[model samples]
Target: MTANETIHPTAPATEIDASCKLPLLALLVGASIWLVIGSVLAMIAAIKFHAPDFLGACPLLTYGRVAAAANDALVYGFCLPASLAVIIWVFARLSQTVYALPLVPVVAAHIWHLGVFVGIASILLGNSTGFAWLEFPRGGSILILVAFVLIAIPTAATFGFRRDRTLYPSHWFLLAALLWFPWSYASANIFLVSMPVRGVAQGVIDLWFGNNLLFVWFSLVGLGVAFYFLPKLTGRPLYSYFYAQYVFWTLVLFGTWCGIPAGSPFPAWIPTLSNFAGYLLIVPVLGVLIITVKTLAGAPVTSSSDPTVAYFIAGLIAFIISGITLHLVAHNDQLARITEFTWFGQAQTQLQIFGFLAMILFGALYYILPRVLGFDFIFPKVTRAHFWFNLLGSVALVIPLAIAGYEQGSHAYNLDAALPALRVSSMGLLLILIGNLLFAGNVLAMFLSWKITLVKSIFSAVTSPLKAVEVKS
Candidate 1:
């Protein structure tokens, strides 16, 4: 094929990137609102750990309910939709096609947001299933699932009908994640809700679903965004396309198995399989880290000046650290000592979800929003502040929790020492709340700026013709 034909098999009919602008904005806005709500719930839950009597009067804000609501809000409400938006955009760009059936995703986004709202409300009302991430009731879960399918269909079609035949690394990650989530989600719901798994198997299913949700869905989306943006932003090609393939396949093959060891009260071999899989994951994790370093070897690391680059790099490091931590904690020795029924598990969750996945989303938004909206950030300082607060807040949140977890685990036989550790972790939660407040503030500022600019433009457009007529008269 000629070069021209290879590059442009089919010219785009419309600006593919701009087609989903409204939907993307809506998703981001909804996600930001949920981020704040989740932060508040998290703070309340954290406080209750140390000061059980603080909000003891309100049953709705009880520790268990609030914690479940917080997790639901962050995972389903904020991260899921935000990641979907990013993936959709990436798919559209790579396919060189406008988002087919654009209104479907827009409507689906609203429904998904409503579903999350109702789901959180259900949890707060004491209707929680007590499952890890599958806390949403069956009805709510099905609603979100249907809405997700609506969104995913068009994305899949875009991939299928792409202008280019060869796929990028990001494309593979995006496609795999989008496909994996629905199956995993449906299976979890079916096992946990529709046809209940027997005693020990229920826990196994829950752990499997929850961990896969993290590794396969959230982590994959983060890595996909990193693959697309890191090289683009730095004006460099990936260090090794071959290594990228290795990273993708390894994650796909091994990611699901790593979650099996999460204290499934099953037979010994089950945990052994999980531990071995977790150890094997180091190969891909190290490959990703090496690729990142080599790709940005000479590139100046300016996360401070460029929030997107900064967050991406921070997330990459977090991913590596989380991987190593997962491997170590999965070991039989460490699992027996540190993991079961301790804050250490929570620490790992926060590190992976917030430090790694959410950070990448933050960076993706920083880079994507302006281009999609056709404007620069109105308040650059707010963006920078958001980054710093998040960085510091995540560090504060994870480190204290890790320390507290170690202490709690070491003294598992002692209850008195655990209380003090809980208090220390609560302080970290306070920092996280503060950081989330900063993020909310930044998002609000951006929205207000956009609204103000839009109103001014409309006003000018309306009056311009009248002024022209007046000058003519």
Candidate 2:
């Protein structure tokens, strides 16, 4: 690849990078800024579990508020925008077209981040809607929905104008994600926020939205990313290509019916039905694991040198672990009795979001950003550190929480048991805080490096004419 190929390449893949460069860069930069914000709040929320007085004086920093704010920031601010950016790039590349209506995403990026900021602020300020993922007030939720639609235009356009007719495995996932989120999000707002579902049905609707956003979107976008990049980075054809459709169909079929806890006040039949669907989901999870493992089996040793590979594998492991954990808790009556509403559930969430989803996105960003920015990573070594801290921090956080939750449950939620569990989970929280600091600092470093390079290029361009005039004179 020549310099031109890196920045202005005619090849379809690099062309895709160029076509969507400006919009995608904006989204990622926004995502990074939010990650730092959300990570700090999450750490604060975790600490309050063990040390209630950590920020006791400030009503604004209460555990409930901090946790909700953190969840909103990470999900809407970081994950959604970053995920949409990935979809845009993949869709364009696969469709073999320069992305159209790029301005829509650029505008959408501003609106989306604004919505996230306002929503998070609302939660911290005690104006949250009190719905799980829909804690954002009506105004914030509406803005977010509008912004999402705007950002999606280029994706829809690319697919419509595609030069390529045959769909790849990833196309199914990305396309499904593209079509699903808008309907799901819009309907949730209509049923839950705007009109308000009567009584218990509100909870059902919220769970439907939240679970779909978590599982369906993750399966579609996150796994879509893995499907594309794993074989790509490793230089191998995808293994078990035939099963790709099965994984897609099963997860899409069942993911929304998950997340209703056992022994909920809702009708017994509802929880039973949801749990059954959750158990069946293991089939798709195992399918993803098998195909991914087969592809990585004989992968060249040098592929691991990429650093992103480590993140990918760690995320895959986390995904499988979380999936199996979900299946077991749903299947075993005794296990649900012990773990329901405990830190065990929270552990499962962290594994799915930070461990599985975030790690996979981190890997994707590391690969995509350089091509879009037209520069090599300034601190390649930082990624190595990032990987270790990320892996260790997630392990420290999830494992301890799971044990704590179980111990707390075993002892029937006694203060003595709670105290010990809190202490253990707090240690994990501290490790996660350190890891987030590294991530934030590295993002800052990368930004500075890119800016410095940009300034030098401009300064040299401005001075070249004067140098030529002096030589000629």
Candidate 3:
């Protein structure tokens, strides 16, 4: 097919449509709920940073546990399921086939959520593993792994049975992510739990796993959505299909190696390798930026009325900014100055997860929801509200945290001087909380409108029968 040739739209078979709709909706609902919950928890955590005594009386709401729970909920609970929904939809669309074993993904989503719920509960109950991303207890981790497999099975089958002979860039990225996540999750769990690494090696593994999960899994999924939607929405072909290959491999090979140096007692070469990987990542970032800019050339810089286009552009810009920030902070001198005991690292995390990945997913959901539901959004204003809230909230959140981190780092010796920065960061978190509330409200409105329509249809069906009988009499 020529570069500009759009994929032919195929009408999904009735059975296929029926099977996929509920599961996709379920994933969406689950993700939105988790987003709100995570936001609340995060707000509490951020507040505690400045006001340490706000909820210090409650053991269950301790800062450490609450922070861990919030992170876990946002990552596994919101982003994972949301990304899966997008991936499954894109896969089915590209394959020109209906999803098989629809119930499997739905069941798996429930199981995954259950696992996260239990894990967070465990953390609150003081059973956390204390291993950063692997804070979940062994049992919860096992449950998640199993759930992942269940979700992956149907995903693989969909790709395997694809009708189209040619694969798209989105397909490659999505497939790689699906494969990478399981490997990374299982490997990390094994090293951290099943067999258990020793001493500084544990830290090495932990950092490696965290970095890989962010770059290899989450970043890839976000990029894949961008690749598909950018061209589709703009009515343009990818600028260079061949360069997309370079973007993919560079990220897969080098991205996995770019872990934060933990000052561990391991061999010196490990940190060196990671630093080198971090610098090398600039290659893929630039490649993606070039492709995106070229593809979007001649398009409006921002379409305020179009949430999807606006969000996509915002996400792409954030991705580039985060990339540059990461490259700078990964340098040896910068790492010593900012990577640890500061909010700098947290800022980077927020930029990547919320700014880039979540924004792209939001755009994808806005695009996909209408297509699947077969109706226009009931509250277009709410959609616009969500976009503005997210964009403004992210800016309000990251900038202060980054400034605070730098100030706090520079004044490391004077604990009293850092208070102002902490308070400023707290204000940023408050904005994030407000933004999240808007998002949750928007999602709830969409579902409520759908439910109202369903109820009206059912009532009409029942009443029409009586009217027909009366007319006959």
Instruction: Report clashes for each candidate as comma-separated counts.
Output: 0, 0, 0
Q: Relative to the true structure, how large is the alpha-carbon lDDT of every model?
A: 0.80, 0.80, 0.80
lDDT of 1 at 172: 80
| Candidate 2 to truth, TM | 0.92
| Sequence-dependent TM-score of model 3 | 0.92
Model 2 lDDT vs. the true structure?
Answer: 0.80
lDDT of 2 by residue, 8-68 (tens): 3234676677788778866877888888788889888877766789997998999999999
Note each model's CA RMSD in angstroms. Answer: 3.9, 3.8, 3.3
Candidate 1 lDDT at 235 equals: 64
Error of 1 at 257 (Å): 0.9
Compared with the true structure, what per-residue lDDT tens digits does model 3 show for residues 91-159?
Answer: 877777888788899898888888888888998899999898889998788888888888888988988
CA deviation > 4 Å runs, candidate 3: 1-7, 10-19, 301-305, 332-335, 413-417, 451-473
